[model samples]
Target chain A: MGRRNDHSRQEIREMALQVAEKIVAKEGLQGLNARKIASAIGYSVGSLYIVFENLDDLILQVNARSLDQLYTVISKTEQQCRQPDACLLALGQAYLEFAMEQPQRWRTVFEYQRTKDAEIPSWYRKKIFRLFKLVEKPLLEFMPTLEPHLCAQTARALWGGVHGICILALTGRLEIVGADSVQNLMELLITNYLAGLKNVQGTPCTPEEGTTQECKA
Target chain B: MGRRNDHSRQEIREMALQVAEKIVAKEGLQGLNARKIASAIGYSVGSLYIVFENLDDLILQVNARSLDQLYTVISKTEQQCRQPDACLLALGQAYLEFAMEQPQRWRTVFEYQRTKDAEIPSWYRKKIFRLFKLVEKPLLEFMPTLEPHLCAQTARALWGGVHGICILALTGRLEIVGADSVQNLMELLITNYLAGLKNVQGTPCTPEEGTTQECKA
Candidate 1:
């Protein structure tokens, strides 16, 4: 119990986050609290407050780490696929896999809310934007003529749809949609959305035009 | 206090639900509990149990009502817009409007979870399936030759996208996407998704082909 003084502040902070993540992963967000974290790490509640502003701050840090890990997963998909469309499909699949694998932690990223009026911290916002850029990079290549602003918008909308599918499927609400696996649904969503994006931009290389050569089969 | 015995059992049940909705609407799901509901209704927690099995049961009932109200809002859009495309757009807009208007309650519909592995009750499932049918009706009309199963999947996908947009926007995560309003994002989603569906089916009338006549501007 007295071991708290042995570790430096940074070490304590990192240890607290790891313990918190494990709690959330096992019991979901409802299970996380400062007391639990402090006790698990053999620290006083007072010491826990010294490192973070409040419980919300602690949760935000945990979510930020989750987002970073998610960004890493999505980034890896980019190197694995050559085409932008294929890259997006890979990213979507990776995202779904991450959500399924770490349902609690991944959900806490979106489900955790601060007070209504509090601004999202800029550092966290930066991480979210970085995640968007992962999608935007390939989208811009796929639709070269899309305005910079429109490209960002398209990226958010598409990824939001992908996220929505993951949420519904994981939550069991997706059962209403029938027997298709989440992977098949993700493929359908990405394929149709890209087809629509191409159509909107008046791009000549339609998926239908040359299914094998132009689009990933 | 004197009015408690004056009402029938059904009236008491309805009153409890209305009170619970206000709590959830104002303070979110975390704020809801039988003690609070009983206190507000001037009844004992025992009476609450008589009407509902537990807090989860009460929440499920509340969610069912929310779904029914949502279905009504969407159904009204069907009458307001004659074209299937216009009707779907109207439905999407109405949905976003509903979410914005009652963000807390609308959120509880998706956010509330039963205890692990408990089957979602059939009555509630029926309400959810009914909601899906609302979308399915207009979708089937839009693409007549679409297979029945495909129509169901497409409806779920498109609505899931709409739902994703609402979740992101209402949570303030949409700020990263830029200056486009939620309505604009909603229009973009439905427009492009329908375009993709039409393309996938090789339909003769593409939105891009006749932007003014076939699709909403």
Candidate 2:
């Protein structure tokens, strides 16, 4: 191992995360561990621990970086399409592309589980929330009078559906139903979901059955 | 271990699967292993190998059974709700309920990955398809003019969205957006997706952008 004073703390931290991401990219999350990362970065495992609390903490940081990259990718969709619905479709397509391009890294962000009672750190939570904000802006533009909480809820529901399509398609579960392509399924989801949202504002005759059912209960 | 002659091959296969399911249910897929299953069932590891090809095979069988149970749960929704849209909502609720009630087993159906290039057995594929068939029935009834392939594709796209919500909610990822309940999010997904489908049939002017785009491409 190099001398402890040889590299600044920030340098070492960046180095460790880079090495960790490489391991996950080449080999799935099951292949990642401290010893391999330390060896790859030319540092002792002790030094690795000095920079992060534990493996879980290291994974959380890696996931945070992934979320940042995803946010950047999805945000770019905003400049490509003029219509709110079109922008959401472009965002869903970008998401599916990212997952296909970086399967392991993308899966790592969702697959890493904390201990049952452990809380997700606030910093990590904030990174994920930022991703949702990209969707929220376009949604609010579509429905100007929608309450803030309902806006957030609508964004989550819509994004959650897109996220689900990507997960099933990437995981091969989509094969059971004879799905042709991730792109097609994603387009279907975004188009249908946006259509439904438009219907809410266009028609007063068709009540929001989901909300009505909730109110009754 | 009991005498090798104490049980027939079918008996051993059934016993091993039961034990494996319990382990997965209590500890998630990471905690499952052949040694653990054998010990739990009071059999030798060799006996496990005799009944199944390996741990992957055992997991496939267990997952197949989980899918069967899921199909049963979703299929029951058919009898409870006569209307196509209402039935789809009931199915979504049952799906969310199943995921919440049996998080491990439901997750294992998706989380267990076979070795790259290993084909999922036909039996397992058929069980999963039956689950899709439940969704397909209601979808076709709602859109009788929809082509057969489109019906299958629509079923997959809609159900994939529901599955995604369950995965995110069950894993605590939805907490970032402060999701109220799995039931509410699921209801939103089904209602919107169905609404979108209804619009496709009700309005000749809105052009199915998703399908039209595909044809143009």
lDDT of each: 0.79, 0.81
Q: Each predicted complex: what DockQ?
A: 0.23, 0.53
Checking candidate 1 for backbone clashes, the offending pairs are: none
Per-candidate TM vs. native?
A: 0.85, 0.89
Error of 2 at A183 (Å): 1.3
Return the lDDT, model 2, position B135: 88
Chain B TM-score, all predictions listed: 0.88, 0.91
Q: What range of 10 consecutive residues in model 2 chain A has the weakest lDDT sum? A: A208-217
User: What is candidate 1's local distance difference test score?
Assistant: 0.79
Interface RMSD of every predicted model, in angstroms: 8.0, 2.3
The sequence of per-residue lDDT tens digits that candidate 2 reaches over residues A1-217 is: 4665689878899999998888888897889999999888888899899999889889888888888888888889888887777778888889998999999999888878875677787887788778888888888887676678777877888888899999988888777557878777887777677667666545555453333322423
Please write out the lDDT profile of model 2 over residues B63-173, one tens digit for every residue.
Answer: 988988888877888778877888888988899889999999998888777878889878777887788888899888877866777888888888889988989988777
Residue A105 local lDDT, model 2 = 95
Model 2 alpha-carbon drift over 4 Å, by segment: A116-118, A205-217, B205-217
